[model samples]
Target chain A: MHFMTALRAAWQQRDSLLCVGLDPDPARFPAHLQGRSDAILRFCTQIVDATADLVCCFKPQIAYFAAHRAEDQLEALVEHIHARHPGTPVVLDAKRGDIGSTAEQYAIEAFERFKADAITVNPYMGRDSVDPYLAYPDKGVILLCRTSNPGGSDLQFLEVDTSKGRMKLYEHVARTVAEDWNASGNCALVVGATFPAEIARVRALVGELPLLVPGIGAQGGDIAATLAAGRTENGTGLMINSSRAVLYAGKGEDFAEAARRVAEETRDAINAYR
Target chain B: MHFMTALRAAWQQRDSLLCVGLDPDPARFPAHLQGRSDAILRFCTQIVDATADLVCCFKPQIAYFAAHRAEDQLEALVEHIHARHPGTPVVLDAKRGDIGSTAEQYAIEAFERFKADAITVNPYMGRDSVDPYLAYPDKGVILLCRTSNPGGSDLQFLEVDTSKGRMKLYEHVARTVAEDWNASGNCALVVGATFPAEIARVRALVGELPLLVPGIGAQGGDIAATLAAGRTENGTGLMINSSRAVLYAGKGEDFAEAARRVAEETRDAINAYR
Candidate 1:
């Protein structure tokens, strides 16, 4: 199935807009699993099992796994997610970009090696760097537009002059990717929920393209404002992601139950806004 | 030793500016070494051994090894370079960037795991995304400025309005990184050898900061123009990299010798220009 079709089916089945980010910091794993060799894998599997019915997708940030030399565990986690939760898509948040041949290698890394349903890519190197990812029509390519961090504005908010007119660098990226790219209909934009106005602007530029909205929970973004600015006409094009808030809801052995409760609450909260 | 000090010592000792890129494409590996489990490692070590005396630095593009599930080989290659060619620096061309915590993981991947002396980074995510790499006072953080690819113009050439009036986006990056972000003096800029004018512009913007210049050999960059545009006042601060042209110069049993010959010619060509 195409990435969008699978994503939509999961959204409909779970009635959820929440995407749980599986960023398992080894230092933050539950005490029981802390010393285990498979700690990250075990922690991520529990989180996925707990929240499978409450999420539209799962995003595993590759850096966390890479840091611990657990790439094999990452591969296992994605396969487990596919086997246990068939419809819910897995987006590997790798944000990789490079020249042509190197970009092809990254595509193989994200899609073939890790079996990610979608992957985030950096747009700094422009079209050719991104074309290899977009070539995978069954997979989604999420390009960074405007990020959530405090220093995001350092370069993204610069005013750039284009043939159309003058617009912020992020706006230019949104419009160009929405119009010039996206030929296969598998492209998505990453617009931080903290920047609701920028989210609205990106939504306007790229009509119903999926926006992976981070910063809703731990990054201090308001859900009401995010929904007001990011949702599509039919209210289904946003993936509001919350990592730390849902994963660390409880410190003890009931962590899975706590995660489930938080996931359900976040899903309900997003649904209420929708 | 500091990265720049090591790099300068190597440049002065070798009397060369060429950086040999060890991008071992399995499909392009010589016939005798093709099917071996250690093909990537053997191929790269052979190239490094052959060309170590001719080049100032060895750049192993991580994608080439990562594509083949040979990251262990990459680690071995860096260790080999450091042990065999002591003064020469190894710049891992990773082009990685992310949020703070994730960026720290990437830094560990490049520095601790692979033991690269310098690593390339993408600047689209701004200051905080880059700080983790900069925190390593002895390592080098080479930021992507004007790339050599055809699609680089799609974004890098866009005119952006800064406080000091309008300039290109890449210029702004050079100025900001040189002026604000180089507190540790470990920062460098990647200005493609393919665009000599932009290289000159970037060199002017970031006064004495090192420039990692790719696009020299197989990418069709003019050596004399690159030297004229990128060289510092003392005829240093430029690392002109060539990958395919040097690595795949021959397809037979003498491939390593062929690589050494090409590397020597390229190094001499660059030195004559300087």
Candidate 2:
């Protein structure tokens, strides 16, 4: 099934829009898993096991895995998630952007090697950089729109003169990707939950297309504002992601259970807003 | 020594600005090494050995290695370059960008794991994203400015309203990076050789800073125009990169020797222009 179809199905079946980001920093892992070589895999598996029922998807940031040279563990984590929670989608948050052939290689790395249902890409290099990932019609390509970082405004918010007159760089990106790209209907935009106004602007630009909203929990995003600004017309197209707040909820042995509680709370909070 | 000092030393010693790109595509490997598990390492070692003296730097595009799960080979290649040709810098073309901690992970992946003297970065996430890579004062952080692809103009050329009135987005990037960032003098910009005018524009913007110019050989970029447009005022500070035209110059046992020949010619052509 196409990534969008699978995502929607998972959302409906789970009745949730929460995407738990699996960014396992060794320093933040529970005390029990600290020195273990397989800490990343073990921690992520337990998190998935704890919160699988409450989430429509799992978004794993590749940096945390690559830092420890635990790519094999990452691959295993994705496979385990698929086997354990068959319908839940996995979005690899790589944010890769490169020239044509290199982009193709990154696509293979994310989709074939890691087996992610979808992947995040950076649109800085323009069309061909993103086209390779978009070529996989069955997979989803989430482009970075207005990001959540403090430095996000450094470039993303620059007002650019287009045929449509002056607009922010992120707005231009949304319009271009929604109109010129997205022919395969597998395209999505990543608008930070921290920037609800930008999220609303992106939502207005791209109607029902999925929006992967990050920066909700630990990043101090207002949950109600995020849901109100990011939801689609049908109230079901935003994937609110929380990584540190849920993953590092407890540093003790009951970490997984703590993660579950936080996941539950986050999901219900999102549902209440929706 | 710092990346720029090392790069400048290598350039003066070799009297060349050529940076040979080691992007080993398995499908394009010579027949003798086609099925070998160590094909990537062997192919790259041979190329490096053949052309070590003809260039100032060696850039191994991480995507190709990551695609075939040959990161080990990439690590080995960097070691081989440093051991065999210590003065020649190795710039790993990673183009990585992320949040602060995630960026830290990528820095570890590039500098600690792969041992690259310098690495390319994407500035889409702005200051904090590039800051982690820049924190290592000894290493080089080359930022993506104006790319070589046809789609580069899609967003890069859009006129943005900045403090200095309406300027292109890339110009804004150049000004910000050159003026605000680069306190450590490790920052550089990537301006594609395919667009000589853009290269000139970027060169003019970032005075004496180094430029990693790709798209020279296989991508049909003009050598003379690139040299004239990209060179610093002192006829230096440009790392002209060519991948396919040098790597896939021959399809037989003479492949390495053929690669050396092409590298020599490209180096000489660049020298002539300088």
Task: Score candidate 2 by DockQ.
Answer: 0.85
- Assess the local accuracy of residue A166 in candidate 2 as a C-alpha lDDT between 0 and 100: 82
| Residue B208, candidate 2: C-alpha displacement in angstroms | 0.8
Query: What are the runs in model 2 whose C-alpha is more than 4 Å off?
Result: none
Q: Of the candidates shown, which would achieve the greatest DockQ relative to the real structure? A: 2
List TM-score per model, in order: 0.99, 0.99
Docking class of 1: high
| lDDT to native, each model | 0.92, 0.91
Candidate 1, B-chain TM: 0.99
- Please give, for residues B1-274, the per-residue lDDT of candidate 1 as tens digits: 7899999998898998999998889899889998999999999999999999888788999878776778888888899988888888999999998888789999999999899999999999999999999999999999999999988888889999999789999999999999999988999999999999999999888999999999988889999999999899899989999999999999998999999999999998999989
Evaluated on CA atoms against the true complex, candidate 1 attains a DockQ of 0.81
* Chain B TM-score against the true chain B, candidate 2: 0.98
At residue B98, candidate 1 shows an lDDT of: 89
